[model samples]
Target chain A: MKIGAVIKISGLNKDFPGGVRALRGVSLEVRAGEFLLMLGSSGAGKSTLLRCINGLVAPTSGRVELNGVPVGAGVKNISLREQRKSVGMIFQQFNLVRRLRVLDNVLCGRLYYNPLLSSCFNIFPQRDVQFALSCLERVGLREKAYQRADTLSGGQQQRVGIARALVQQPQVILADEPVASLDPKSARTVMDILREINQQDGITVIASLHDVDLALEYARRVVGVREGAVVVDKAAVKLTPKDIENIYGGAKEQEVYDGTYGRLEYVRA
Target chain B: MSELKRPVLPPTDRDGRRQSGLEKLLYLQRALIIGFVLAVYLWSARGTNLSLPELIEGFPHMADFFSRMLPPNLAILKDLVRPTVETVQIALWGTSLAVLLAIPLGLLAARNIAPHPTLYATARFILNALRSISEMVFALIFVTAVGLGPFPGVLALAFHSAGMLGKFYAEAIENIDPGVVEALEATGAHKLQVIAFGVVPQVLPEFIAYNLYRLEHNVRQATVLGLVGAGGIGFELITSMRLFKYPDTAAILMMILATVTLVDYLSSRLRARVI
Candidate 1:
């Protein structure tokens, strides 16, 4: 809606080949340097929306604009790849090349800038390697840089994921349920790292989260989706229980909305 | 409180039978399969005029021939050494050439990695055509074309093994984890880069293992390729047998066996280490 919005989705709709309507005419704007949390049930189009931003899943109709450039269905492969370079993605599974060393997995983020021959031989420049090591250091995983990525704990693997994204030097990071596979403590640690990245580095972060309390604690802004449409959009502090009720209608009350504000106190204490 | 408790048992049919209709049918089917196999074996034995008495009568002749070829003609071992080394060389060269040709074909034939359906189908068709012809048949053709030598033997092995290795490579590529590929693609890597960083690392060890297996197989095939005059130890065995030099024939056979055994051991060890 704003003139200088970093990511703009307008009337975006994505219908999968099997006729599943994952998104329906969704419109949203993400400001630069904001930590935006998207809340939704399993099939509520949150992941699809994030994928659309990076051109991973092409939208069926309408458009998604990133930094004033159109990126969606019908964009050229070269331009789409260029657009993807500025939009880092972190997955719930921490999808590192499991057999490779942690440093090599993190260096994958710099593949766009490296020459084809160098990337094939895994010969990154010294500066890029140092930068990757620093990103690992920032995530408290500098010691595990030489270890195989699969040998680490779940939280440690996610920290590697963050380090990989950070190596891209991206303007925006899209984390699709980054902590859904972690225990509560590890989830909190990942959220803290993402928040630190957002606040300290001024990187725009759009994270889709399942936990309401975590979203409220870490997000500057929260957008709620129901079925395939946004149902609520508000600043985190101004979010109300009634808005959550509309988003999760007909689901089990206690499981979906019961622990909304209670976990905040637990996290604080 | 004084009464003893009884454990509950599973319910049965009204007739109190343990076997169900499905179980009865399964038993009948198994019995029928066994009977059919027995009948086929008996019919084939009768048709081929197989006689136990004839086999017993032939044992003495086999023993006589073995006795004539006794001691393995160890003095001729040096003469047989060069041919054995040539056979192994043929196998090594053939397998290396096959690997070179198979890599591109396999990349094109793999469904997930192929850029277009037409390319995939064409590559698959070529591979199948290559596989349909036996290695011995190819050896015969190449021997005719090249006028007889280890060159023809090598060519035959390379062409035939390429078909097999290419199919295996395609399967390995298709089976790799898609998430890793997606992660690479999300980082703005090009198509070739995705394949190099994502697909190659996942499949390299398996490709190497398969190549080693093919090398072992090709070594055995190379020994036999010379039977059709493509030039190897088989040529020596055939000549010695034709000339009635039983001792020399025995030496050549032993040499072939030893070479194949060594190749098998080395390939298995390499595969164990790689995988």
Candidate 2:
């Protein structure tokens, strides 16, 4: 891990309407060029933490800093948005505009860099269009550029989502369960792509996942969350059966771990 | 342990019995609602002097008027053409003006897109007030204010249609998938950029659909606006009727019907393409 943290979350807390405390004084650091996986069950606050890092959800208290700039609620509106341009996000649902062409959807990622008037007019410069196309190519969906986003299958749409995020040229990519909605093969393909991006481009990746075996296969660092707090934080290779038990509310960790590892080996073959 | 026996009885309430009292109360409530509806209908009928005998007695007079209106006048068709075209023009201009004015108002009134609650509420109130008054009433007011012409008729239709279109546009805006807007915002898009990309594309087909529908309605209303001397086929119709020119009246009615039918068909086709 690098010495400098790319993203810093210190004592973060988020209380939603109706007094739901989604995050409870959580603090973590993401190093430069690291593949960090956040493991949690549903409602474990992993999604909220990722959103807070990207300024989608403001922390009720504490601070989130991206590239040494404050990005949470207290930051100025313009600067907060400016900081957000450095971070890319992928959702589990692949939230592309269904009615828009895939190319237009990818171009939307560069909206922060373009002038308001030009972007509104949809007059993307040729260079940007080429760049968007190259990003789509990287995701292996170049030929699907002109297709309506909704017409694509679940896996293909998620690849389009990846292309959109990649087009931003962000230093950090935050993915909230990017493969949770896909089949096993597609999920592995997405993970491999994310891993490749992390390795080749050296962009820091923080993804939340429900699948422990996938995390073991891809993540260099793992953070386990249970009920809005980190239960375990360590290197992926160092995580033990006890840590898995702690994260999953004392399920049969040894049996699950062995079963998952066996599947991972078979999948790798 | 022996074959895992299951209950055979039908499910019931907590007391293990169906509640007859509750069922009886529900039935009674439905009966009372029907009775109240019937009573209200009868009361309204009496208040409005809507008697079946009266309608039956008036059929012959209607027949006599229709008989006099026929033996049709094809000669006045050319004279009716100019005013018919003018009525269509009025509708076209009014619909265009309403669309232009309503876009901003509708954005302001949409709850999700409005910058503030106060602005949303105020815009909604203004739209409601505008829609409450009929187009004919607005025509009458504008005619007195701006003097009789197609211009006043256009203004009246524009104002009335703006209220209706604004309400519909706001509803379309409000019904958009919030996730798309969120994704755009997460990309650091400005408010205008969010609206252009996220909101506009999703609601545009509906907006065009509503505008075409309103144009069709406005064309029909434009003819009636001329009744108040606002300049269209209606003015000619009223004049011919007062002078007992039944043939001329019949010709005017035919022209209006043909124009409205053509417009309705074209607008429906356009709407089909849009949706």
TM-score against native, each model: 0.87, 0.91
Q: Ten residues in a row with the worst lDDT in model 1 chain B? A: B8-17
Q: Candidate 2: where is the Cα deviation over 4 Å? A: A1-3, A72-78, A250-269, B1-19
Candidate 2 chain B weakest lDDT stretch, 10 residues = B10-19
Residue-level lDDT of model 2, residues A55-115, one tens digit each, is: 7777789899886678844455547667777788888888899999999999999898899
Across B1-275, the per-residue lDDT of candidate 1 in tens digits comes to 25778986667565556678998999999999999999999999999999999999999999999888876777888988888889999999999999999999999998878887799899999899888988899999999998888999999999999999999999999898876777777787778888888898899899999999999999999898888988778888888888888998888888888999999998999999989
TM value for model 1: 0.87
Off by over 4 Å in 1: A1-3, A72-78, A252-269, B1-10, B13-61
Tens digits of per-residue lDDT for model 2, B201-255:
9999999999999999999999898899887899999999999999789989999
Clashing pairs in 2: none
lDDT of 2 at A90: 87
Identify the candidate with maximal TM-score: 2
Error of 1 at A23 (Å): 2.2
